[model samples]
Target: MKERETWKNGKEFLFSCIGVSVGLGNIWRFPYICYRNGGGAFLVPYFLFLAMVGIPQLLLQFSYPQYSSSGPAKAWVCCPLFKGIGYAMILTNSAVAIYYNVIIAWTLYYLVNCFTLHLPWSSCDNIWNTENCYSRTYGLASMTGNTSSYNTSIPEDQNLKTNVTLSSNDSKTATEEFWTYNVLQLTDGIETMGTLRWQLLLCNFSVCVIVFLCVFKGIKLSGKIMYVAATVPYLFLTILLVRGLTLDGALMGLRYYFIPRWAELLRPSVWFDAASQVMYSLGFGTADHIILASHNKFHHNMYRDAMIVPVVDAFTSLFSGCVIFVTLGYMSSTFQLDIDKVVTDGPGIAFMVFPEALSTLPFSQIWSTLFFLTLLMVGLDSRIVQVQVLTGSLGDLCPGLFRSRVSWTSAGVCLVAFVLGVPFVYQGGMYVLQLVDWYIASVAFLLIVLLESSVLAWLYGSHRLSEDIAVMIGYPIPKFWQVFWRFITPCCILVVWVMGLVKHKPVTFGGQAYPAWSVGVGWIISLVPLMPLIGNIILTLLKHEGNTMQRLQKSIKPLPEWTKNLRSDQNSEQNGDILL
Candidate 1:
C-alpha cells in the first residue's frame, strides 16, 4: 500500500511547489537585483546558474524527499549520518514560515484598508479626506504607545538628487555619485512605522487567519486555491506592466532597468547575488518544495515541470522589474527623487515603497486595492507551503503522534505556528521580516546547496545519476545537464559560497548593536551543515572492526525501482524472484 498521502496528487503537487517557489521573492527581489546587478547583463549569470546550480539542486531536493516519502528530517535517512542538516532545514522552515506568514497577513491588512480608501501614511496634510486623502495628515505611534511628529513629504518630482555645498573660499560644489542612489523619492532607507504596534498586530493576525484557513487541509486544498492565488498576481502585475510602460515615464524606467554597465557584468559579486536569487526564487535546495512535491504521482514528469518552474519564475521576475522601474520612473519624475531611493527591493519594496507609490496614483484607492489584493492572494500559497512543510515534517517524523491516532495533531501544529508568530506582531513587523528572513532563509540554504551538490555531483558519481535520470525520463538527459551537474554546476556553487565567506562581515544597522553572543550564534548558524561533515569525514577515515563507521561509510544502494526495468528485460534467462 502507498499509505495515506496526507496531501494532494500530481498536478496539485506541482501547483503547490510552484506556489511556494513563486512568492514575494519573484516580485520583490528579482527586479531590483536585476536593476542593480547589470540589467540585461544580470540575465547571463542568472541563466547559467539556473542551468547548472539552480535546476540541478532543485532536482536533488525533490527527488530525495519524494522517493523517501519523508519530510525534511527523514528525507536523507540514507545518509542518517547527516540528518542534522535536514533538521536545520526543518527549523528554518518553521522559523521562516512563522515570520513570513506574518508578512502575508500585513498584505491582507493593507488590502482590506484599501477598501476604506485610507492613505494612512500619505505624508500629506490633506490625507483622510477620502476624496483626496493624498492631501491629508497622519500621525505615527511608537511601540510604547507614544505619538511622534508626522510629515507630508510627498515629493514634487521623483528623480532629483541631494547635493552638499562645498565649504570652500570660492563656494564650489563637487558631487560624488554613490551606488545607493535610485530614481525616485530617492531616500537611502525607509523604516517601518514603529509606532503602529496595534495596527501591525491587527494586520498580522488578519493574514494569519487567512493562512490558517487555506492550509488547514494542507496541499490538496491549497493546491486548488493556488491555481487562482498564484495566477491572479501575475494578471495584476501584467496590468501594471502594460499600464506603467504605456505611461510617459515607462521607457525611462526600462532604460534604468536594462541599461547594462559592462563593468558591473564582470563583478564576481553580481554573479553571487544572481545565484542567491535563483536559489531562493526557484525554491532550490528547499525542503519545503520536496514535501509539497512528494505528493506528485510516480508517473508525473515533475522533472520537466521543475525546469519549467524556474524559467517561468525568471520570466515573471523580469516582467515585474520592468513594471517596477516604470512606476519608479514616474514617481521619480513626479517627486523629483532619484530611482535608488524609490527602488528598494524584497520586503521593504513590497510593504513600503510600492504602497507609497500607490498613494500617489490617480484613483489611488482602486490601485491600492488591486495591488495589495493581488499580493495577498499570490503570497497565500507561499505561506501555506511553509506551514505544510512544518506539518509534514512533524507528521512524518512521528507518524502516530500526528496520524490516525492523533486526530488533532494538525490543529496542534497550527496552534504552535500561530504561537511562534506572536512575538513578531510588533510595530516594526517589517523589521522582524528582514531579521527572520536573514536568519532562516539565507546562509543555511547556501550551505545545504553547497553540501548536497558536492555529495550528489562529486561523491555519488554523476554518470550513474545521469543514467537513472535517463531511465525515469525515457530519454537521455541532454549532455548539458550531465557535464553541468558533474563539474560546472558544483564548481560554480562552491565559488559563490567561498566568496560569500570572504565578503561576510558582522551585521549591524542604524547604530544598534548585536551582542557578541548574537554574532557567534550567527556564525554557528551558518556552519550548520558543515558541523556534521566533520563527523562524516571522521567516520569514513577511521578503521575498526564491527564499527558503526564501516556501516555508515557504505554508499547507498540504488532503489529497487531503478534496477527493475533492466531486470525485466533480461528475465527470459534470469530469475524473476531474485529481482523481486
Candidate 2:
C-alpha cells in the first residue's frame, strides 16, 4: 500500500470531511425532501433523526478511525465476525464514484450553456423530442437517471398545454410529473444529462483531470486544497439565496419549505424516510468520511471535530433548502406556471428551471454564470469525495495500483476512471446508480452499521470506547451520545431496514410496479456483501470448533490489548468463557 498520508490539522481534515459529507445530496436532495415532507416541518423530523441517530452515527464513524487507526479495511475489524464489511464498503464507494463524476459533468455542461443562455431541458420537448440538436437538453444519447421512466414520460407524452391550470386546491401537476417536485424536488437531481448531452462526456473528462491532479499529491495536497474547494459551494449558494429570495415565487417555495403537513409525521414510514434522508444527506456510511479520517492524524479533541462536521453539514442542508426554494419559487411565480408542473423534471428541469429563473433577474447573464457555477461546484463538491472513496477502496482491493509512492497523474487516473465509467455512458447506467444507491446506502451501509454497532456496543463494549475517548480528551463523550452509539442509532436503522422490507410495497413513482421477481432481483442487485458474511458464518460453524465467538477470535490476530483491562473487569464472568 502507498505510505499513509496524514493530515496537517483537524481544520483541514474536517474541511475535507465536510467537502465529501456535505455534497450535492444535502444541497439538492435535502431541499426537496424537506419541501416534499413539509418544508419547515421537514426540519422537525430531520432534526429528530439527527438528534436521535445521525449525530451519534456521525460521531461513531469519526470515532472509528481513532479506534482502528485504519480506513474501512481496518475499521471493520472493530467487529468480530463482520470484519469483511470494510470490503463491501470499498466496493460501494468505488461504484458510486464513477457515476458521481457523471453528475459533475452534468453541472459543467449546464455552466457552459449558461453563457449561450440556451438551457437544455427547459421545455419538455427537449426531453420528449429525441433530437441531434443541442438546444434540447437530455439528448437521447445521454443515459443519466431512470431513462426507462424518463423515456416513457417525454414532454410530448404530457398533453397539458404550457402553463395549463388543472387543480382546485394546488394539487395540479404537469401531465407526467414524477413523484413530487418542490424547491427541493425540483432541482436536487439537476439534469447534467440534458441538452448539450456532450457536456456529460466533456465534464467527466475535465473532472477526471482534476481528480488525477488533486489526488496525485495524495491526501497532503488534497487536504490543503479542500480548505478552499469545500467552501466554494456555500459562497455561491449564499449569493443565489439572496437573489432568489428577492424574486417572485421565492416566498411560495419557502412556504412549501417551512410549512409541513403534520399528518405526514404520523406515518411510521415518514420517520423511516427521515432516517434514510439523514443517512443519505450526511454521507454516513459510504466510506467517504473514513478516507478523510484515514488521512487525519489523531487528536485529543477529534470528537469535537466529529460533532462539528455533522452540525456544519446539517446547517448547509438547512440553508441550501432556503436557497433552492427561493429560486424555485421565483421560477414558479414568474412563468405564471403551476408550481407542481415545474417541480419534478429530469434534465428538462435543470436546464430550464434556473436559466429561466435567472432570466427574470436584472443581469440574468451574470446571475446565470454564478448559478451554473454554483451548481457545478455543488456537483463538484460531491464528485471529489466519490473519487477519494474510490481511490481508497481500489488501493485496498489492488494494492499494486499504488504499493509504494505512486504518481497521482492527471492522465492515468482519467483514462482509468473514464474507461470504467464509459459503460455507464450506455442506456442502463442510471438504473445501475439507483440499484447501487439502494443496496449501498439502504443495505450495505445500514446492515454493516447495525452489525458494527451491535458488536461495539454489545460485545466490544461502549464503556470501553467511552473510557478510551475520555482518557484521551480528559472528558467522556456525553451520556446522550453514549446512549446513542450503544442503542438509539442502531435501533433506528434496524427499524427502517425492517419496515422497508416488511412494508416494502414496490410502488413505482410513474410506471407499473415491477413484478415480485424483478423486485426480488433488485434487492439482490447490490447485496454483494451478504454472500461473504453468510459464507463466513457457515465456515465458522463448519469448523466444529466451538461457538461463533471462539471461531472468530481464533481467526483474528491478537492486538496488544487483547486481554486489556477494558473487558476482563465487570462483565467478564458472564460472556467471558463464550468470548475468550
Candidate 3:
C-alpha cells in the first residue's frame, strides 16, 4: 500500500477546509437568501439546521478519514456496501467542478475589463446593447418600496418593486445587458448553442491553468497556497464593507438586510431555505471535507478544526452579506430604487448587480477590479480544493496505478474538467450550466448526503465511530451529537429531501422553462451519482455468499484492516506519547 500524504501543520488543513466551505455562494448567495427568508429571523432556522444537520455531518467528514486512513472514495472499509456513497461524492463534485470553473471564467472576463477607464457594463453604449437595454436610470424616477408593492416591507421586503419594474416590457438593465450580451452572448435556448465565445474560452483556459499549477504536485504546495487563498477574501470584504458603509443610503440597505420579519418564520419555505443554505454553505454532502481532512495526521484535533471552519464559514457569509447590502443600499439611495430592485441571489448578485453598483462609485475601475478579484480568489479557493479532492480520491482508489503519479493524475483531471467546461463558454452554455447545476447539485446531492449519514450512523454504528474519534482526538463525542447522527439528523434530512422533491419545479432560466428534451437530459444528469450506489448494492448481494440477512450482516461488518490503524493510534495514546 502507498503512504498517504499529511499536511505540514494543522493550519494548512484548517485553511484548506475553510476554502472548501466558503466559496462564491457566501458572497453572492447567502445575503439574498437571508434577506428573502426574513433577514435576522432567518438565523434562527439556519443555525438550528446547522446544529441538527450541518455540524454532525461535518464531524463525520473530518473524523471518518482519520479512522480509515483513506480519502473519501477509499474510506468505506467498515461498510463496503456503501462504498458507492464515496464514489457518488466524487462524481457529483466532478460535475460541479466542470461548470463551476465557467463561473470563474466569467469573473476573470470581468476582471480583465476592469482595467478600462470607463466600466463597460455601466451604460448602454456597447455594441452588444440592444434598443431594449435600459440603464439603471431608466425606471428610477417612479420606483418606490411601500406596502402598496407586492411583498413590500419598508425594512422587510426583499423583492420590492414599483410602477416601473427594474426590467419589464422586454427591457434589461445595462448590467443585465452586459451580462447577457457581452459576457455570455446568450442564445435563445439550450437547443441553439450559437457560436463559441472565444474570449470566455480563453478565460476558462486561464482558470484551468491556475488550478493545475496550484495543485498539480499535491497538498504540500497547495496547502501553503491556501494560507493566502483562504484569508485574502476576508481582507477584500473588510475593505468593501468600510467603503460600502460610508455610501449614501447604506443604512437603509443594512436595515432591509437585517430587520426581522417575525411572520416569515411561520412559513415552511423559510426553514427549508435555511436548511438548504446550511448544506450549500458547508458543502455537507459533497465529501470535499472528507477528502481534504484525510490529509491531516491521525492524532490531529479535527473536532476543534471542524468547529472553527464552520463558524468561519458562517461568519464569512454574514460579513459578506453586510458588505453586499451596504453597497446595495447605496445603489438604492443613489438611483432612488427599492431595495428589492437591487437584491438578487446566485450568479446574478455578482454579475448583474455588483458590477452596476460598483460603477456608481468614484473609482469604478479600482473597485470593480477589487470586487472581481475577490470573486476570483474565493472561486479559486473552492475550485483548487475540489481539484485536490478529485485527484487525491483517484490516487486513493487506484493507488497501484496513481500512487506515484500524482502530477499525471492532477493533469488528467484538470484537462478533462477544462474540456467538459468548453460548452459553458458557448453562447447558449449558460442554460446548460444552469440545468446541470440545478439537477446535479440539488436533489442528487441531498440524497447522497442522506445515504452517507444513514450508512455511518446505523450500518457502521455511530457509537463505535465516536469512540474511534475519542481515541484520535482525546475526547468522547457528545451524546447529543450521537443522537443527532443516529436519529435527528437523518430524520431532518429525509424530511427536507421529501419536501424538495414535492416542491420540485421544472428548471427554468430567465423566464423560460427548458425544452422537454433538455429537462429529460437534466433527469439523466441527476441520476449520475446514484448509479454507483445501486451498482454496489447489486454487487454486494451477488458476490457475498449468503442468504439476505446473512449477506446484509456480512456487508456491514468492518474489515479487520479498518481496525489496524485505529488500534495502533489507540495504543500510542494509551502510552505516555501520541504520534505527531
Candidate 4:
C-alpha cells in the first residue's frame, strides 16, 4: 500500500482553508443577507452563531481530517456505518462544483470584456440592448425624463409629452439589460432549456482549464497558487472601499449597513438567516474543508488554524459588505433612487447592480475590470477547493487507480465537472443554477450538518474527541467548547433545521414559479446525497454474518486502519498518559 500525501507545512494548510472558506458567498451572499435580515441588527445573532455554532463545528471538522489523515470519504473511520456521511459530503460537493463553476465562467466572461476601452455594458447601442435601456446616471436629468441623449429613437407608442414624464424605474439600466439579454441570455423560466450560448461555453471551458492547472499537481502547486488567490481579494476590496467611500451618499450607505434595527433580533427568521450565513460562509457541512484539512500532518495544530480561518472569513464578509453597500449608496444617490432599490443578493448584485455602480465612477473601465477580476479570483478560489474535494475523495477511495497519476486524475475530474456544467451555459441556465443553489446547496447542507453534529456529539462522544484534539494541540480543551460541542451547537442546528423546514417555499426565480416536475427534480437533487447512507445501511444488514443487532453493531464499529492510533490514545488516556 502507498502512503497518503500531506500538505507541505502548516502555512500551506492554513492558506488552503482560507482559500476555500472566503469565497463568493462572503462577497455576494453575506451583504444581501445582512441587508435583508435587519441591516446592522443582524450582526448580533450572526456573531452569536459564529461563537456558538460556527467555531465549534469548524473545530470538529478540522479535527477529523487532520487526525485521520484522510479525505471526507475515508475520514469517517471512527463509525464505519456513518461512512455514508463522507460519501454524502463528496456527492454534495460534486454537485456544488458543477453549478458553482458556471458562476465563475460568468465572471470570466465579464473579465474578458473589461479589456476594451469602453465596457460593453456601459452603452445601450449593442444588439442586445432594448429601446428601454438607459445608462445609470445622476442629477435631475435622470429623475426627470432627459433621456433623449440615451435613447436615440423613442418608440412611437409614446408621444413626446409621455416620454418627458419617464422615471428611472420606467426603463432597465444598461447593466441590467446587459446581464439579462447579453450575458445570461436568460430564458423565461426553468422549464425551457434554451439553446446553449457558445460564448459562455467557451468561458466555462476556460474556467475549467484554470481550475485544472491550479490543482493538477495537487497541494504542492495549489498551495502556492492559493497564496496569491487568497490574498488578492483583500487588496481589491481595499481599493474599492476607498473609492466607494469617496463617492457621494457613501455615508448614507454605511449608515444603512451598520445602524442596527434592534427589533430584528427578536425575529426567529433573523436568527435562522444568521445561522445559515455562518454555515455557508465558513464552508461548514461541506467536504471542501474536510478534504483540504485531510492533507495536514498528524499533529498539525488545527485548533489554531480553525480559530484563525473563521475570523478571517467573518472579517472578509464585513469588509465586502461595506464595499458593496457604499457603492450601492453611490448608485442610489446617482440615480435618485432609494438605497434598497439598488441592493440585491447573489448574482444580481455581483453581475448587475455592482456593475451598474461601477459605471458611475471615474475611470469606469478600469474599475469595472478590477471589480470583475476580484470576482473571478473569488469564484475561482472556491471552485478549486470544491474540485479538490471531489478529486481527493476519489483518489483516497481508489488509490491504485489514481496515486500514480495525480495530475491525470485531477484533469479527469475537471473534465467531468466541465461536461456537467454545460447545461448551466444554456439560456435557461440561471434558472437551473437557482434551483441547484436552493435545493442542493442550502437544504442538503443543513441536513448534513445536523447528522454530522448528532453523530459526533452523541455517538462518537464529544469528550473523547476533545481529549484527542487537546493531545494534538498540546492544550487542555476549553470548558465552553465542551458545552458547545455536547449540547448547545447541536440544539442550535436542530432549531435552524426545523425552522428551514417550516419556512420552506417552492423554488422560484425573479417571481417565476417552477413547474411541478422541475420542483420534483430539485428535490431529487437534494436527496441524491442521502441515497449513499440508505444503500450502505441495507448492504451492511444483508452482508454481515450475525444476528440483526450484533451485525448492525459490528458494522458501526471503527475501522482498523485509521482508528488504531485513536484507540491507543484513548487507552493511554485511561492510564493517565495521552498520546499525540
Once superposed on the true structure, which residue ranges of model 4 sit more than 4 Å away at CA? 138-170, 564-580
In terms of lDDT, the best-performing candidate is: 3
Q: Relative to the unseen true structure, what is the C-alpha lDDT of residue 274 in candidate 3, on a scale of 0 to 100?
A: 89
Q: Candidate 4: worst 10 consecutive residues by lDDT?
A: 138-147
lDDT of 1 by residue, 359-434 (tens): 7677778777777776777677787777777677777777666644322555666577667776565433433444
Tens-place lDDT per residue, model 4, 1-580, is 4567777778888988898888888888899989888888999899999999999999999987777878888888877778888888888888888988888999999988888877887777665555556775521222332344323443433222223433456677778778977787666566666678899999999999999999998888999999999999899999999999899989999888888888888888899999989988888767888988888766679999889988899999999999998998888888889887888888899999998788766799888888888898888888999888877887888988886578998899999998999989987788888988888854667888888887887777788788778767778778678788889999998898888888989899888799999899999998899999778778867777889888878877767776654565577779998432
Q: Which stretches of candidate 2 lie over 4 Å from their true place?
A: 1-3, 117-199, 345-352, 360-362, 393-403, 408-416, 438-442, 503-521, 536-549, 552-580
lDDT of each: 0.61, 0.60, 0.85, 0.82
Candidate 3, 100-169: lDDT as tens digits? 9999999999999999988989876665555555787654223332213322212122111121223447
TM-score list, all predictions: 0.79, 0.78, 0.93, 0.91
lDDT of 4: 0.82
Worst 10 residues of 2 by lDDT: 179-188
